[model samples]
Target: MYIDGKWKAGNSDFAVTNPATGEVIGRVPDANEHDIEAAVAAADIAFADWKKTTAYQRSELLYRAWELMVRQKSQLAELMTREQGKPLKASLNEVQYGADFLLWFAEEAKRMYGQIIPSARENQRFLVHKSPVGVVGAITPWNYPISMITRKLAPALAAGCTVILKPAESTPLCARAMMEIFDEAGFPPGVINLLTVQNPSRVGEVFCTDPRVRKLTFTGSTQVGKELNGLAATNMKRVSMELGGHAPAIVFPDADPVHAAKGLSLVKFLNTGQACISPNRIFVHEDHAEPFIQELTSRASRLKAGNGLENGIGIGPLINELAVGKVDGQVKDAISRGAKVHTGGQRLTEKGLSGGYFYAPTVLSGVTEPMRIYREETFGPIAPVITYRSEKDVIAMANDTEYGLAAYIYSNDIGTAMRAFEALDFGIIGINDINPTSAAAPFGGLKNSGLGREGAQEGIEEYLETKLGGFAI
Candidate 1:
């Protein structure tokens, strides 16, 4: 890990295992309280001088980092695929997306405009300035290791806030690689610290409790997000959390089943369904459920599951055995509860896939709200589809969950698409689109999904604190 601008070993180390082959790829530091404090303290010291630098200087450094990321994109993606278990192509795309954040924030850095408020006194000139929130502790998840860190870190650093990034233990190499880019880009020591720790909750507690750390940003589960929110509340630390999601894809009667199915298959099974925003529930009109199911199942079956490094493989191994068990259990419970398994409901134990944890892409029908698969976040490649008669009924079922991260609609009718998307309670909405939104728009969730947004013009504001002042002439 790089701490205070120096490469150093930790008190203890933990093994990093590759999910594809179940082999120990490398080891990262098992950071203790001391390590977490030291990193935060370094960030605090760096923030003093770092925040004073002009936005142009910050943008230059960030742009250089983005360039380096592009240069090393392939290598970074390969390493990420080997570690995080996403397919090589997906990993590469993620790296590219990750680089785009740095580029976007690089340009957005200089555009942090403040407000001029009219004062009650005629002689007073009221002005508001946006300043960095000082030291930030960023906790990113393992799913999209590179991009998630970049999305948060880019904005924070570009906004002149020093950061201590605690990347997921399962995928620390990508974070290390990013630190390399930042160092090569000539960022000052302690301006950014990468700390890899096995005890993430402990490190997170330190981040929440410490007064020196002014802000905390995390991307993970809703349950964990709630706990961390409570912890951050102790110190009144500014927080930006992107939590778990149970996204629903609503297919209205007017849409083309085949097109919707193909697009849904692309996003639904991406990263083997290990994404927070991955479409979880499939709600199709009763009239089109048969064709939609056939199209969706056909597309899913075409997605080959194997080691991420292998070409032509769409779905890879689950992160670990636990992930495999979760998917399997959900499928099993749903099946036992009268749900029909359309295709690919079991695990694959072939010679080549014997070692890794690989569950086949599954499609389930006759799903009801009482089934386990319908209730939980089945973070795997299983699609439990439920049929609905009316738009009003499906919209009610979609908004029934506590999660509201993202919702999808596939409809040719503009009125149906707009009205349905608006009625569904989610932060981001996608109409006839598989991969929803872009780096140019704000991404986050409503309700239990999360707080604060990332990306677009709104992203930089999360790291800045507005200061309002006026002086009478």
Candidate 2:
């Protein structure tokens, strides 16, 4: 972890394991209350100077960081695959995606526009400025570790705010690698820090209650987001949360089933379907349900599951035994609840996967709302197909869950697509697009999915405070 511009260790440590083969990768420093407090104090001090630097200078620093990331892409990607268990190609892509954020925000740093307001009185003048929110504490999850950090880190630094990050225990190496790159870019002491501890709750509590930390951003489960949000409310600290999601990919009657299946296969199985924005629930019009299921299942079954390092591999192992259990339980429950497993159902204990926690890309047909898989976010490679009759019914079913992060419309009809796009409660609606996330777009969700946006113009707003100045001449 990077603390006060130094690569150092804490009094304690925890071993990071490779989920693919249940092998110990390495150990990360396990921080304590003192370490957490020190990081917050360092960020607070660093913010004093970092906030004073010109936007152009900060942009230069971010650009340097981006360059460093690009240089370390192969090394970092391999490290991520070993620790996080995603495919080598996906890990490499994640590094590039993470780098893009830094590059994008390096330019975006100069675009924090203020506003001028005309007062009712002729002699009065009002001006609003976007200022940094001071010290920030960011907590990101295991899935897409580097990508999540860059999404927040680039924008926060670009906005002239100092940050301290707490990456998931399972993926600490990814964060550490990024922090090393930040160090190479010559960020000043205390400008950015990373803390990993055995007691995450305690560290998180400090982030919420500490007066020195002004803003706290998190990407995790909704239950934890709500808890932290409530605690942040105690001190009235600014919060930006990216929480859980159960994304619905709706295939209308007019849509081509083959085209929809082809697209869904890519996004749905990415990261073994552990992504919060992964299309967990599928709502297809009944007329095309059979064909959709057949095509989807055929594609899913053909994908290979094994160690991420191997070539030609599609799906990888789950993060741990717990993930395996949760995914397996969901699949079993769905089957017991009258859902039929179309293609792949059981866990893989075959060659090259005997010691690993691997589940085949599963598809379930005859799925209904009563099944457990229908309601829960199946953070696995399981695609459960639910058939619907009309636009209104599909829209209602899509918004039935507490999560409203992202919803997809695969219809060719302009009117139907527009209606579904407007009616869906999710923050991001994909109109015939599976991967809707872009560096320039505002990325977030509505309802229980999350609290604020992470990319685009709105992304910078999360790290800044609006200050209005009034003067009478």
| TM-score for each predicted model, relative to the true structure | 0.99, 0.99
In candidate 1, what are the lDDT values of residues 327-397, reduced to their tens digit?
A: 99999889888999878999998858888889999999999888888879888999888999998899999
Instruction: Give all candidate RMSDs, comma-separated.
Output: 0.9, 0.9
What tens-digit string does per-residue lDDT give for candidate 2 at 142-248? 98989999999999999999999999989998898888889989999999999987668987899899999999999998999999999999999999999989999
Those runs of model 2 whose alpha carbons end farther than 4 Å from true positions after fitting are: none
Global Cα lDDT for candidate 2: 0.91
lDDT (C-alpha) at residue 429 in model 2: 87
Q: Rate the local accuracy (lDDT) of all candidates.
A: 0.91, 0.91
Residue 467 lDDT in model 1? 95
**TM-score, model 1 to reference:** 0.99
